[model samples]
Target chain A: MKIRPLDDRVLVQPLEEIESKTSSGIIIPDTAKEKPRIGVVIAVGTDEDLREKVKEGDKILFAKYGGEEVEIDGKEYRIISRSDILAVIED
Target chain B: MKIRPLDDRVLVQPLEEIESKTSSGIIIPDTAKEKPRIGVVIAVGTDEDLREKVKEGDKILFAKYGGEEVEIDGKEYRIISRSDILAVIED
Candidate 1:
């Protein structure tokens, strides 16, 4: 079954970041660290202005504890309100 | 100096509740109790739609961890975002 977010909400698929080395040769570990709130937009809400600003497949930056997790068709996704979105990650 | 909230925020003076006995003879103790998120709107934000919904001196219900506290002229108040407001209480 498919889920459609209502009002000024969006469905997002969170990007899980693993341990990685930075340019400074420092290892950033994901274990015990706050999960990054970055995600890709799966479905945009029906709000006209919000739809104009955010499109499907666009990457987004959301608040640290913003979205609600929902399991759909064995896939995990988050439903985030418009106010919780911090910015649209450009490029 | 008088404070004016910008955007879709509101300035509110929290209404603190004290220990009181209910009609059911249940003495509702205030000690160790979570502070109620109810307050009177001191000032409304500049957003037109928000202004239309909330007004100064209006009693409102806000999210538990929604607003930021600030002291103005020795009086404590909270700055709450529009999305954090749950409902406007009517008397």
Candidate 2:
């Protein structure tokens, strides 16, 4: 089933962080790592103002713990309000 | 010194949460408590686009773990990007 965010919410798919290793080559466990703060906008809410600021496929930086997590078709996603979106990443 | 948040960042002074007690009247320790998710906006960034969306003195809901904490003039404040803000509390 397709998930659509309502109101000022947006659906995001988080980008994976590369594993970090110490100088001794010891890999840090996931539990000890900081949460990722970047993601791609998959869907946006219907709010006129919010729609003007964000769009599908935009890479955005968000608060690490801002949104609700959901799993769809084995992939993880987050639904966050427009205010939680920090900045759009442009390359 | 007054803190002026840069870019789309905002300075927030967190609201205090009321203490909760169990049926036996035992108070929970602060360490065991959840972070406050609400705050008063003390300052907003210079970004014109962001200024249109948020304003100083607006009470907002933010991600609990989102911002960077700083102590200024005996008061605690957090500096967070606009994206870390979840919603405006209008009441």
Q: Which stretch of 10 consecutive residues in model 2 chain A shows the poorest summed lDDT?
A: A19-28
Range of the 10 consecutive residues with the lowest summed lDDT in candidate 1 chain A: A19-28
**Pairs that collide, model 1:** none
lDDT (Cα, tens digit) per residue for candidate 1, span B6-72:
9999999876542111111212123313322557899998888778777898766455567799988
For residues A1-91, write the lDDT of model 1, one tens digit per residue: 2344545778888665431132123333457355347778988765689999999988787765675554434455666789988778766
Clashes of each: 0, 3
Error of 2 at A68 (Å): 4.4
Alpha-carbon shift of residue B30 in model 2 (angstroms): 13
Off by over 4 Å in 1: A1-91, B19-36
- For the candidates in turn, chain A alone yields TM-scores of 0.76, 0.78
Off by over 4 Å in 2: A1-91, B19-36
Per-residue alpha-carbon lDDT of model 2 for B1-91, expressed as tens digits?
A: 6788889899998776431121112222334233325678999998887787777988665666887999988888999987677555444
Query: Per-residue lDDT for B88 in model 2?
Result: 59
The whole-model C-alpha lDDT of candidate 2 against the native structure comes to 0.68
